[model samples]
Target: MKLIAVTNDRMSIDELIQTLLAIEPYIDAVILREKSKTDTEILKLIQKLKEVNFNVKKMIVHGKPTIANTEQIDKVQLPGGLPLPDLMRQYPALLFGKSVHSLEEAIVAEADGAESVLYGHLFKTNSKPGLQPRGTDDLRRIVSSLTIPVYAIGGIRPSHIERLREVGIAGVAIMSTIFESEHPKNIAKEYYDAIHT
Candidate 1:
């Protein structure tokens, strides 16, 4: 399975870069989901990342198609409720993804030219406490119903890999786990092995 790491707001910019670089070889991509940062700040960070020659193609800007287009970044993952139809037409070289919660939303996202989707809350995550998990059954249905890649997100752990694989997911997007790990390199390797072996 493809392993994409999602960034959290808790870390400093330098820490973020160090963590991403450490694990880049193990993970497939890094989704820059820094929603708290201003557009200018995000764009600057994107530029700096490119300046450092990081694989920008492996970076997905969250809800920022313009920045993606400007930087020629290949992927953009739209957050929930942000509307921009026919993304393929506007950003021809870019692949768009969406975050969805249910089968209905997943279908809608696929219909909206989203090449991939992130669906979950599959387990009790620290970030989202007191919420019911969507579970593997719904994950199975979502995966079966869509031709596009469905990456399970939220509360994904190394132990969950077998169930996720059985449920037919294409990949996973994990935040907190990689970003907050004291040894991101080892954790990333563990995640990769879990998915592949």
Candidate 2:
């Protein structure tokens, strides 16, 4: 399974870069999901990552197709219900991804031409509190409906990999559990091991 690291608002610029650098080797990509960051701010962060020799291509800018195109980053993840079919046609060069909550949305995304979808809250994590998890059955249903990949997200842990893979998810995306860990590299490695095992 492909492991993606989703960024949160808590980390400072330095800590974020350090975390990205440490975990880069283990994760397939990093979704820069700092939703509040302005387009200019996201662009500057992209520049910084490139300056540090990080793989900018593996970084997916959240909700900013213009910035992503100008930066030549090649991937932009749109928030749910943004109606990306037009954007996908407009920027054929860009890989468009989405965040979907249900099978119906996943099918809409697929029909609308999203290259992939990120789905979940599979087991409850600090990122999402109190709400009940959508669980593996829901995940499997979504996976079954889409030809494009569906990545499980929200509250995922290392121990859940086997079941996720069994359900036919393309990969997993994580947030707080990775960034808050004492050793981001080791945390990423643990997930990688679970994926490859």
Candidate 3:
């Protein structure tokens, strides 16, 4: 199982860059999920990352197709509601992954030409207080139904990796697990060791 680190939108650009640089070797990719950041801010973040010789290829711009195109990042994770076919047509060189909440959404996203689908909140999390988690059953169903890669997200821990692999997911997308930790490098390595070992 692949381990993907997601940004929590809680860090300054400098902190984020350092954290990402520290954890890069232990994870496969980083999803730049800073939703509140503007386009120019996002551009600056990318520029700074490049300045540090960060692996921009491992960066996936979340919900920002133009930034991905302009930076040549090659990957963008889009919301399920977006017109995926149109985006795929407009950005033929870029790879798109749809963020989905249900099996139906995953199926539709794959048919619409998404290279992958991020499905989640499979476990209860601080990110979604009081709401019920979608659970492994639904996740299993979605995984079994989709031909493209299905990356499970939300409240995931290194301990849950084995069960997730049993569910047939392509990988896991983690946010607070690494981003919120004081020792992100150690946390990332622990998660990576769990997935690989």
Top candidate when judged by TM-score against the true structure: 3
TM-score of 3: 0.98
TM-score, cand. 2 vs. native:
0.96
lDDT of 3 at 66: 91
TM-score against native, each model: 0.94, 0.96, 0.98
Worst 10 residues of 2 by lDDT: 35-44
lDDT of each: 0.87, 0.88, 0.91
lDDT by residue for model 1 (1-197), tens: 89999998777677777788889889999899998888888888887777777887789999889988888888899888976476677778878899999999999998887889899888888878888888888888999999999999888999999888888888998897887889989999999999888
lDDT (10s digit) by residue, model 3, range 1-197:
78889898999889999999999999899999998888998899999999999998899999989999999999999976889988888999999999999888888899999999999898988888898888889888988888899999998988999999898999999998788889999999999999999
Give the range where candidate 3 is weakest over 10 consecutive residues by summed lDDT.
79-88
Clashing pairs in 3: none
140 Cα displacement, candidate 3 (Å): 0.9
Candidate 1 at 28: error in angstroms? 0.3
Q: How far is each candidate from the true structure, as Cα RMSD in Å?
A: 1.4, 1.1, 0.8
Model 2 Cα lDDT, one tens digit per residue, 1-197: 79999998678677899899999999999999887777777777888999999998699988888888898988988988686978987888999999988888888888888999998778877777788888888889998878999999988889989888889988999888888888889999999999998
In terms of TM-score, which candidate is stronger, 1 or 2?
Answer: 2
